[model samples]
Target: MARSLRYFSPRRECPFITIDLGSIPESLFESELFGYEKGAFTDARKAKAGRMEVASGGTLFWMK
Candidate 1:
């Protein structure tokens, strides 16, 4: 909920990029931000990309 205020704020650096905070699940913390391959851990059943890859072409702002 703390991250929501960033969306409503009008003043920001012109060249900065912002990613939304809503719809983030707590369980996704490990798999989403840091890329981990399949079998890297016990519960990882399949290979998948992380947010760093998704945000590779752009700047990603993580609020707090």
Candidate 2:
């Protein structure tokens, strides 16, 4: 399914940001989707852009 989507029109432009929901842990969902500021968490050493940010100006596909 992801393969076909990658070859399609809008998805073709941003093929690297595809997300498989099943692989992500429920606890990490927020951080992954919205990203975190520097020092936002104990393990966070620097600010990081979330999936949404990375997918900006591109496509973001959520797979079940």
Candidate 3:
């Protein structure tokens, strides 16, 4: 199921991002999805964009 989705190409000019929900830890979900601003945490040294931000004007696919 995931293989086909991974290979599916959209007829658009946006990027595609996929997330394997089963492989990700529950604790990291929030930060992974919404991201955080630089200096928002002790370990955050540089500004970073989350999945949602990266997926802007693109496609975000999730497989369980």
> Highest lDDT: which candidate?
2
Return the clash pairs for model 3, or none: none
Superposition error at 39 for model 1 (Å): 0.5
**TM-scores for every candidate against the unseen true structure:** 0.48, 0.76, 0.73
Q: What is the C-alpha lDDT of each candidate?
A: 0.61, 0.83, 0.77
Q: In model 1, what are the clashing residue pairs, if there are any?
A: none
Clashes of each: 0, 0, 0
- Measured by TM-score, the strongest candidate is 2
Pitting candidate 1 against candidate 3, the one with the higher lDDT is 3
Question: After superposition, which runs of candidate 3 have C-alpha atoms over 4 Å from their true positions?
Answer: 1-11
Summarize candidate 2's per-residue lDDT along 1-64 as a digit string, tens digits: 7567567766576636878899999989999999999888899999888999998877788898
Better of 1 and 3 by TM-score: 3
lDDT of 3 by residue, 9-51 (tens): 5624566778889888998788888888889888989877888
Candidate numbers sorted by lDDT from highest down: 2, 3, 1
